[model samples]
Target: MQQGAEYSLDDHGADGTRLVLSGHLTLASIGPFDRAVKAIDGPIHAIDLAGVEEIDTVGAWVVCRAAHRLSSEITGASPEALRLLASVQDIDVDGPMRPPRPPVWERVPLAVGDKVFGARSGIYGVVAFFGQILIGAGSLIRHPRRFPIKALVHQMELVGVTALPIIGLMSFLIGIVIAQQGSVQLEQFGAESLTVNLVGRITLRELGVLMTAIMVAGRSGSAFAAQLGTMRLTEEIDAMRTIGISPVEVLVIPRIVAATFMMVLLGFYASLMAIIGGAVVGDLTLGIPFWTFLARIQEVVPEHDLWVGLIKAPVFGLIVALAGCYHGLQVRGNSEEVGRRTTMAVVSAIFAVIVLDAFFAVFFTEIGWG
Candidate 1:
């Protein structure tokens, strides 16, 4: 049987007030005593626990809190009670629950610094990833038997063959738009005949490969990221490593090889389709025969224009594939990360392709390939 806790207050005039506690000072008996102590007001000089039969952590916490609130000393406690009080006091944290927000000016600089640091780290990570890719390529070259031929073939079909219809349709529509617009503008100058020159030069030298790259980035690059990200989330990537497999070789290298090999064909095919589309539009609206427009393209378009597109194709493909695989490998945490990385892969690949195209344009113009 346990006695309920009880407390009484005494005042000693100039010496301040004292709280005297008695009975079992424990969880089972402390409730009313706690409420009673809280109701008492005025300065308290000491809490006398001499009559307390036994005390537990809850009772010690209640006593310590009252002592702290009143700025009073604790006296006449047994060694066990004192020890419990000390432990509770030690664990009690005193501070605001939340931090203050920084000023806008401080926040702005911190945000900028974080972005700069993140960009630097991202660049370093890309360089390191590129190095790993090179190493993997070298190892594969030395051991041809370890090459992932089936995966490369499958990726080639996915990245190239299945994409042909959409690429062709897009190119055809673009060609019709360019030819119609160019003819309208050229008509003002009485050079409607020059629509062939405009369409051929622009399509072969720039739009054909550039448009194809963007399409591939959106299609195949996103697919790569999503596939690899899912694999990562499911721990399939870990399982592969556990079983002595190289994910880079089995997964990434095949995608890179497929995209690189297929881009040349896809770019050329897209350019031809665009030219055919222009010829069709010319026949219908510009009074030029279909065959005549086609023949005129060969005569007006320079050989270097075709070479420029072909040269850019493989490089663009490599960039797209690398972006996809890198982002995919970076995926962590959850399914949401898979979608995020996939989006990043497409955006990064497209951005890189456009930037590189600008650089290539400058280089070609400087070297007389323009």
Candidate 2:
């Protein structure tokens, strides 16, 4: 039923139920629809949706309810009744469905470029790195008594002594392989006497120290980043600062200092094992007894070779420590951020170590020392 429309019901017609609405089917017209159905005097066995122009959920629901009651009164209702019910099935009472919008980049009001460096994250990273190192050193100097001796010992054990077996095995195996390869080429020229110098200089100046740095970067660097990143994500770094303690002092210095010393130890041990293993290979293939080869090493391997390896230790250590601490502190208080920073720390530290090794190689070569 609609405003300005007439409604009629034919109870005894061929259809047994005939209803008509002759105008627009709006919300305002449902009342007559309700009354006509209610006021009908016979069974209502069918309904029709053909006349509906645009019925809302409420209007649609009224038709459905009338049709249902009518069908119960009779044995079966026309499929028109079911069709009306089906048409409104997708309507939502919560609200009309709106398509989801994609996220848009809206400019934030604040100005980071003006406040910080205009366009220089690399320079900013360098400054922050040096600043954190100074803060760490000063904090240690100021509070020597409160330094984390227990944590230092624990970290030292983790990064140093516990890694000996794998380090020794790797260094020894590498020594054997390098000597075997060198023997094949040197045997052609009867220059196998050079094996001692080769093994000595290569192990001490490059392979030993370089490999040690990579191992430490992969081992200790990830640990430091993950530890501090967890703290950063939990706001424990903020808590330390709030309590008048710098996170660098409480977290970074111990790791940096420990890694510095451990790297030197690794370099020394890796060099020694490599030399010993190379000597074994020399005895087997070059007909040089172990002691004779050792004597040759003393004659040919210069003091500077050892010095180069030792000098690289602290640099590699600092790179690993700084990379780890930097990535850790960059964490933005999320578990995924902690994991990302830890992975970044390991990767960046290894890259820095290798890059610095290349620079060292160039420097030594320029000085006629390589």
Give the winner by lDDT: 1
Q: Score residue 224 of candidate 2 by CA lDDT.
A: 87
**Candidate 2 local Cα displacement, residue 305, angstroms:** 0.6
lDDT of 2 by residue, 1-370 (tens): 3353245554675767755433444467667667766776566655544454555555656655565655622222236544555776445434547866544432232355454564487568769878877977876788789788887787788888987888888899888888889888888998888888889999999999888888888888988888888888788889989998877766787888888888899888999889989999999888999989888888999999999999998899889988888888788847998888889889889888999999999998899877
| Off by more than 4 A, model 1 | 1-100
Report lDDT per candidate: 0.94, 0.77
Looking at candidate 1, the ten consecutive residues that score lowest on lDDT are: 89-98
- Candidate 1, residues 1-370, lDDT tens digits: the string is 8789988887863677889998998898889888988887788999999999889999999999889888899999999998999899865535467898899999999999999999998999899889989988999999999999999999999999999999999999999999999999999999999999999999999999999999999999999999999999999999999999999999999999999989999999999989988999999999999999999998999999999999999999999999999999999999999999999999999999999999999999999998
Candidate maximizing TM-score: 1
| Backbone clash count for every predicted candidate, in the order shown | 0, 0
Candidate 2 weakest ten by summed lDDT: 72-81
List TM-scores for all candidates, in order. Answer: 0.74, 0.67
Query: Residue 231, candidate 2: how far off, in angstroms?
Result: 1.8
